[model samples]
Target: MEYPGGTREGGLPRVLSDPARLAALEASGMIGSAPEQVFDDLTRLAVSVTGAAISAITFVGETRTYWKSVPHLPYTGVENWQNGVGESFCYFAVGADGPFIVEDAAKDPRTAGHQAIGPWGVGAWAGFPIVTTDGHAIGTMCVIDAGPRQWKPQELETLAVLARAVGNEINLRISLSTAQRALSTAQSALAVSQDLARSLQDSLLPPVLRPVPGLDAAARYLPATGDVEVVGDFYDLFHTRGPWWTALMGDVCGKGTEAAKVTALARYTLRADAGDHLSPAEVLDRLNTAMLAQRAPRYLTAVQATFRATPAGAAGRLCLAGHPPALIRRAGGRVQQAGVPGSLLGIMPTIRLTDVRFRLAPGDLLFLYTDGACEARADPHSPLPHRPIFDEEALAQALADTHGLDAAATNTHIAEVLAGHHGGWASDDTALLSLRVPPNP
Candidate 1:
């Protein structure tokens, strides 16, 4: 075949003037891009195979020859290995039909006066064209030595194979970049959806707890640890009417959207029925009825308490619905569990909860909590297959230890202890409500 740009005397190669080849090189989208590590690795491999002082993957562009990778080259305070198109040996290699080798650039007529010989100190050189799938040569994979050396035929073949491998790496990198961008776009969309779900879940619970006269009350609701998913644990303390105030805490079965729905339904029903002046047990029964009507595939355990002022102090009635027992800490540091037994709600049509009536003297504390507190592991970091449970016995001991602490301090202390026991992350959701009757004024 005839050459696009005719060869010079002694068959010295020149840049091709074929527009089709130039267009293919321009369409590759690799020119003037940031250097890639994959190309750097290929160049290093070429250096190892040829035992040369310098190895580079070069792209021959219209105006300049760019070194995509030159692993062993020292920094010269310049941008990169870039030179005028005709000044580098890669220019001739890109135009050659096959591998091009010059045993000594100083004596070879083809490269004797080349600019690469004087300042670059290139004595011996070997290069192979990096051809594209469409039969267009875009660049070269090259090795250079500072001293004259003859390249064996097998060495020439190895360089040819390395050149093809470099081509494959470039294509792989482009495909990988495209995939990473697509993954980033999908992750952004998922984050937006999770934020919306969290907001909606927050709206379903009480915004803030109101203070009740003559009582120091504090409550906490902790979601399950780790990923941000909607949990079913909730607590609220609000006044019904007149001198009566009601407080409720519950945990629904399951997680995510379905459990969240049941949690919202149960909270609204309890608040709506509080104004009827019903007993603590009656209110929970009403909640059970409403839950059964919805027929949601979830169940929950709950504790409800109604407080009213008495001559000696505040008196209250506690009702349990398949939930953990409430604890009563006397002014004298005696801890007693309410120990009311009942069945879970939402599962049975006619559910009944036991009501345990008790009076709180000045300096007395009433503590209500969910099963998460009892089932917590004693040593979360233990390597043993099973860890000890932080059951009611341990909890009662903790309460007894905090004898004279007020409502807020007591709750904070309990929370800290629970966090310590669980390695600062609760495996399940936790809810705690503390009600303290102040001393007589």
Candidate 2:
């Protein structure tokens, strides 16, 4: 069979034959793996976003293509679940090590005569490579349509993000397996486990907050001490569209892989819905629905703020579900609470979420955090029999004290205050996000 790009000669891409790439694929252990809920959730999400008839997580091997998860198609056995390497479009993504999209498979030169098109009834296809940490293309998270249709840019971008999520999941399992093996030779298995925990936790969150035009933003994540398991605290700040931006913080109910999966789903759903909805309540409502539909392993509480910079300052809506209220610092150094109390997510069929409108004048700032900040307590090892918790009143006082500080400074000061209370050993994971309007010249 002929390949698409000239990068390959007559047969498949050289990457398919590369020993290292093949080794990474084998180590993934997903070649003939049974269907799992996590992958199923992702494929379902892909279909929902792309409006496709079928969505799949496919891994291409040297001789065959394996379908790990296909929400529309049930898995019977390994022999019945795979096809020859040249029989599917998955190799196009693997060979090019990138996305392979075709609005019309029958007309596109790359896939005109593809063997799977007729049997699969694929009128259109869009796939993104699931690459490992070491840069090996393992498989793809793709959507397939029964009739020809043009895909939108946003839909494709979301697909790419989901593909990376699949890659992260695979790499996490690989890392855990390596850590388990290291237990025999390593002097301290605990240290190796902690490193693995931190890595997995980091993947669930954004490394740094993205800048929003006319708004000052800063964020920080503090992990609980002495815990080798991954926690579920996460925060993100991003632009939704022209002039609009969103900032959110959430804490899931459990730890380890279960909580991680829920966190990933929440973040992905939040991003996908935020673009279409302007109200924070609507965005989070959609998230709650998605969580329930996906059968999320853990329930979570989240606070989201969606706002756009105005000529006078910044104005937008803030919503909270089964979480603490958001704190706002006025230019006069007065700190006050915002957000209406509502239901937590993924626990019940019905929920009540309210979006409260808010505005920030020049020199004013808005702050969001997990319960860890206000619930902080002295180290358990301390001599004091009764430890005092850093309650909401104390948090408000700390925020008010940073009257003239910028967004970054405000977050730094609050983090320092929390550390002082906990003695640098937090009991629960803490996430902090702040957005401040610049003072007028």
Candidate 3:
């Protein structure tokens, strides 16, 4: 089998020579590397195809003495440069820039007297230079047979065709090396971004909301979804001036730094204004004013409420902004959402806040959460929409299902239920705050 250049020289045995096959190989280029890689690959393949003990690919120019793929050559890398380029068959390949096969190099005038050839006892030598697309003889793909060889036209031609492939392969190697470095850099950047987001999200949560007396309060804030960078959802519980302690929970429209800012603003505003109003409704009204005044990145949906606790462990005045009504279960075991909703804070400044007058009797509980709870989903398409609302019925049932749950258990239940609802995925940041009103002494 023969392609365009010349026949192949046989040293070991077999049939890698065929014109149709050479065409196929030439068209189907080397991948994952630069042009120079093509030559290197050709040299290695030549060693296997020709059954030669040694093979090399040499680039002309500054790398004249360099053997690209010397399989059985001793001490061969780019640095073994104690000899002249004229002493090598690798140099002759550069002159031919194609197949240059010698059955016995010891008697060949071009290499017979070569210093390294005599010392190394090199006899049979065959090689071809790899030419670049620009027609420069950049490198050679060659094979060294220790003994003599019967030359075959098909074999030598196959070697030449393979040399062409090596040119492209060399280019591919360069490209691959460059691409690998780029990919590594991108992955590192992504990891760092994730780490920073997690740090920021954690820092957004206040270390201590302090403690509200007589109220066994505990809260958990988690990302709505897999994005560790999530922000904008939070819960706050602290002693607000006098006999009144304010507890407010809210979420922004979106997730990230913008949302985080709004959350911080809302929490601080509630704490500052909690003592200003004796009624829960008044507290929300003030918060509404605050939200409208700030020009943030986006609008927000939030629930801000103040609970006046009695020594009996019940809330005296409960004011709520636009948000889910509270779920209350008395010691007697009856449960209901302290139905109160005026409007969502932040969206409107002159929002009307509703106040539910009630006492959180001893041994009662309050369930607070972001929309990720009631509307949480388990399946993206499990006979439910993405944001399924818990409504009044669902909320009551959830509380009843986990009645008298301690801080850890209650939060865990909430997380699992939310996860289950979303098909094991909370599409947004889900937050849960559960408190059990202590029994009266």
Best by TM-score: 3
**Tens-place lDDT digits, model 1, residues 1-441:** 223466644343445546776776666666765567877878888888889898888888766777777777654533566777767788777767578899999998878888778766799999998887667788899999998999988878888998999777665654576678889987887788679668866776566668878888888766667777777888888898888999888889988899889988998899999889558888889888888888967999998999887777788788999999999888888999984889899999876677888889998999988888888874456564565778999888888877888887887888888887877668887888889888766
lDDT of 2 by residue, 260-320 (tens): 8999999999999999999988888898899989999899999999999999999999999
- C-alpha positional error of residue 317 in candidate 1 after TM-score superposition, expressed in Å: 2.4
Highest-lDDT candidate: 2
TM-score of each: 0.68, 0.58, 0.69
Q: For each candidate, what is the lDDT?
A: 0.81, 0.89, 0.64
Candidate 2 global lDDT: 0.89
For model 3 the local lDDT of residue 138 reads 50
- How far is 411's C-alpha from truth in model 2 (Å)? 1.1
Better of 2 and 3 by TM-score: 3
lDDT of candidate model 3 versus the reference: 0.64
Clashes counted in candidate 2 amount to: 0
Ranked by TM-score from best down, the candidates are: 3, 1, 2
lDDT of 2 at 134: 96
TM-score of model 3 (CA atoms) = 0.69
Of the two candidates 1 and 2, the one with more favorable TM-score, higher being better, is 1
